[model samples]
Target: MAIDELLDEHEQSERVREWLRRNGSALILGIALGLAAIGGWQWWQRHQANQQSQAAGDYQAAVDAIQANDKSAAGKVQALPEGIFRTLAQLELAKSQVKASQNEAAIGTLRAIRTSDQALTAIVNERLARVLIDAKQADAALKLVATGDSLATLEVRGDAQLALGQREQARDSYNKALLKAEVGTPQRRLLELKLTEAGGTPPKTESQS
Candidate 1:
């Protein structure tokens, strides 16, 4: 090889060595981070599986008890003390009460769900609010879906607030309900109708807030 070409090749090799010297710790750190992330994900998946298994068992027991027409027995499952287990118990109790035509007791069970599983809080509150409305407990339902409550969806919030005569607040919540794309097709159409009923325009079609 020519002397100049040899010198250039040596220079390139030195530069590569220098880069490795400076960034070796960073490279090792990146590998460690990747390994830790994978480990954490696996650990989380296992924990979630265990939780779901336990909750499922409790829910099944409740269902069996209900099928036997034993209302009190349906509520006596060995609960996992948290998560969907507790929510399942409340839901079963509510179902039993509703079956017996005890609207008051059903509302009480659903209301208990509002503070049980926080991740499922929005759904529970919405269902409970509907039960409350059906039972003519609009005032209590309104309290559960106040201006800043985190335990309800926008659509249900709007409906509950409207039932309690909070027109303006209900309008805002309907607008929000229109924004979430997760509510599709017939539900969206219904929400649009509700918005009009509340004297507001649907989202992206008008400037009403």
Candidate 2:
């Protein structure tokens, strides 16, 4: 019992002396690192919250402007003229633009989104291709398809192939889409329609060359 007590006292004394030896520097560095980590986390959390809040507020304001039947006001207040907002809003607004016989303006909106948002660029390009095909701008449409941003969803790829006069390829895309979709699903029905329109049966899908 005495030996153990003495050993414990010696350990406590060594720890005290060691702390005294390194005193200020060790404490400062430990405090500094803890503060740096805490500060960094707080900064990141605040920044993320701000960006999300901004995106949400901007979206709500634009929705309100649209509900008031003011296209010009909505456009003016929207966050982007050529980026994320421009992509979704204009895409949503394109039908209205077309109904107003503003085909050129609708096309312009989609084209602008294609340049600014790489994440959505592929879908925009795919839609742009369809619009161009409808307008008989075949070469331009093909170019957009070639520079796709995302994995070409089967629907988009099928439409692109049909536009390019590649009926076989269109059938293939439709077939893949049908397989990916569940039986009796709406997506499967859509793919079937596309295949029928292409005038070809589904081909056996091997590795994409």
Candidate 3:
């Protein structure tokens, strides 16, 4: 190699080293940040998984306690974190309270539950309206159920209307509920009875037909 070519190569190598020296700290910092971000994401995923697992276990325990009619079930349900499981637990607790003739408590229990799911909210509203009716808050119950056309909602609305002495409206609501409630089911039979009590005729049964 010529002397000039060797000197040019050496200069190129020195330039490359100088560039590295100038930017090495920035490159190292970027790599460190990237690794930290990955580790943080992994930690978050694990934390979420652990939370879900714990929630599942707590929910199952609450269910078992409720089914056994344990008096402490309400506390367990109340202690549940806000989520689907907690909403479901609150529902079970409300039902138990209702069965124990604690209508006021059931109303409170049902009211405390909140969810973003429209369908689940409708179910909760139906249950809450029923308790409202039992508590003689028929006006509130009617208002709560007035917007829903579901069979359960209609039936509860009918009950509320009946409580408010709106027999004709009750009859209409019961008929609406009966239209959606399948024949031969207990729900259909109950709605049919309610329709009759509201001075409306129910559809003929198979035996009657």
The segments of candidate 2 whose C-alpha lies over 4 angstroms from its true place after superposition are 1-18, 66-69, 73-86, 114-119, 146-209
lDDT of each: 0.73, 0.67, 0.93
- Cα displacement (angstroms), candidate 2, residue 115, comes to 7.8
Best by lDDT: 3
Expressed as tens digits, the lDDT of each residue in 82-191 for candidate 3 is: 99999999998899889989999999999899899999999999999999988889999988899888888889999999999999999999998988988889989889
- Scored by lDDT, model 1 comes in at 0.73
Descending-lDDT candidate ranking: 3, 1, 2
Candidate 1 TM-score, true structure as reference: 0.57
Per-residue lDDT of candidate 1, residues 137-178 (tens digit): 778777666644332467777887788787888898887767
Candidate 1: residue 131 lDDT (0-100): 78
Which model scores highest in TM-score?
Answer: 3
> For model 3, which pairs clash?
none
Model 3 lDDT on a 0 to 1 scale: 0.93
- Clash totals, every prediction: 0, 0, 0
**Candidate 2 structure, TM-score to reference:** 0.59
Which portions of model 3 miss their true places by more than 4 Å?
1-16, 204-209
Worst lDDT 10-window in candidate 3? 199-208
Tens digits of per-residue lDDT for model 2, 18-132: 8878786888888999999999999999998887677766766665565566756436434544446555665666545556666676677666554445656666777667677
